[model samples]
Target: IHWHMNISNQINYVAADEKRQIIPYIHVKDMQGRVTEYFAKDSPLTPDQIAKAPRHRMDCVDCHNRPTHIYVPPDLAVDQSLLARRLDATLPFLKQQAVTALTGKYETGDEAMQGIAKTISEFYESKYPEIGKTKQLEIRNAVDELQRIYRSTTFPEMKLDWKTHPNNIGHFYFNGCFRCHDGQHVSPEGKVVRKDCDICHTVLGQQEGAVSMASISGTTFQHPVDLGDLSAVNCSDCHTGGTGP
Candidate 1:
């Protein structure tokens, strides 16, 4: 299957009487010529008629921008390792120290790998010498795992990290859905593509466990931080992956 869009120069020709620009919709197709297309709510074609006149043809990578080569962020890697018991959380400050070690600046991938090993080994050996002595093998295994994580997720030669390539599955970290769903796309008739969040997802109760079905059904998300209202916000506007706190 393919997912593509129409981005011809003509699409950018500015129309008067609008504060925002309009762009074409995303299109999808399979090898057998079967096609599925997504359009702004304001699209002229009705639902029954859109497939015959898709705006573009698309492939796997249009949304899955990175397929094989994925760089996991240092924080996420540490969290996953701790969850999987690959890195012991009983060790004080392991998560914080691991992230710091991985994200440290280095001249090359080899240098980064060596530095990761050295930094982590030195940290445990110096600060918690008794634990280091008793759990030498476990400590060594952790160093190896962290080194592996860093080597796999980072390419200092290319200066690539999570920020360079975006995962389009969610709105956070990058402008995934907002690339088209910002509600700016409008038809000549002045109708707009709805940017309602519920169109994509409904909030199940967050941060609470063992809730009843009634609690999960109608509860809306409450942003931990007060951002006034979310109508004007896109998650990518603030969540810049590793670049952010």
Candidate 2:
């Protein structure tokens, strides 16, 4: 099981102040009442204050979003305790959501839940190489029910909250490539060219398993360097003070 944000476009309700305004609050507690974070909208904390905050804070789906695969870790890679609570909560919601995705309504949610249960059973049965004779009939029955549902409806549109720009706190608290080099806006206006493979280098063994990181021969670099005997036109060769012609 995994933990991800279950909300979107979050408007925090903090009526503790005089004005009844919903601040952009991130719910930092899970079902087990663990503090995953302590983010507040207007009450920005200083470095010292932030340092004093707790390490673990829990949040809903608005914070833990899935991008293709479950890329985020730490806060998202759920354990047994959290998973059980989430499963109990998610199963009912999943039924409603799946039905909505299919028929655009929740009326069929009960039936959808049954179908989901059967599908899960079938999936587990098929996961093994071979089932015992005793298990085969049960697996068959479960799978047959799931298959009926498959013909009955389609899947939902998978949505994700992704990083549109750099520097904003990540969609998740995990390692991601977009955390740094998410090329959106730049200062030097095209000077930091959006790079492609062909712009500076070429991929030789694209289909092959192993490929070289070194520059290919004959691709003369714009900034060339010369040594006594050998000549290097590629970057890093002379930049690192290597002998080149």
Candidate 3:
């Protein structure tokens, strides 16, 4: 079975008028002597032109490229830790401090482990003395979790980390889907690949602080920070899998 079947239900089909461009397709003759024209809704390529063009058979790995060897970024790692209660969210500045410690330059794995522990411990000890003293266990647990996260995602010996590899899964930390659907790949007829957010999946709900927003229909994405004209920019332009954007 094809992978598209798995996510077919999630695909939000755009109206005919809203579609900016159609995917490039061609006519091919199979070994069974059947001639099939794999064309899009409004593609303008002639049969002769398409026959002369290159052909690529789509496969799972073409999109799902990083099934293993996954490197989680510091910010995302910290968020996962907080969600799973591995890191104490009650500790103020825990996310900020953890990411800082992880993103800091270190020569070796041992140095990174030591640096992460020291960074988290010292931050709480100096900034929030009361919490540091009273919640010593929480701080220690957070430090331990952070160190584990650092060890798993980062390898100073090989000079490798999340940033070293591009995980083409989503358009959050890297230009995953946007590489093809960035509204720039135009055909001769001026049709594009279509960069609409709802083309793939629907964002059912979003939460900001105490307020939560939801819709039966998908809602437009809201960036955490107020950066103007996000549509014009790729996510990877700003999100560099680091401590700061």
Q: Which TM-score value belongs to model 3?
A: 0.73
- How well does model 3 score by local distance difference test? 0.72
Clashes of each: 5, 21, 0
lDDT string for model 1 (72-161, tens) is 767788788889999977777787678778888998988987887888788888999988788788777788888888878878898886
lDDT of all predictions: 0.64, 0.31, 0.72
List candidate 3 stretches off by more than 4 Å.
1-56, 205-213
- lDDT of model 1 at residue 195? 66
Query: lDDT tens digits, residues 28-73, model 3?
Result: 3444555444344443656566556555444465457778988898
lDDT of 2 at 139: 46
User: In candidate 2, which residue ranges exceed 4 Å CA deviation?
Assistant: 1-108, 124-181, 188-245
TM-scores of the models, in the order given: 0.63, 0.21, 0.73
lDDT tens digits, residue span 146-233, model 2: 3344333322233222111111123122222122122321222232212222443444322223643344442322222234322211
Sum up the clashes in candidate 1: 5
Backbone-clash count (model 2): 21
Could you give the candidate ranking by TM-score, starting with the highest?
Answer: 3, 1, 2
**Best of the candidates, lDDT:** 3
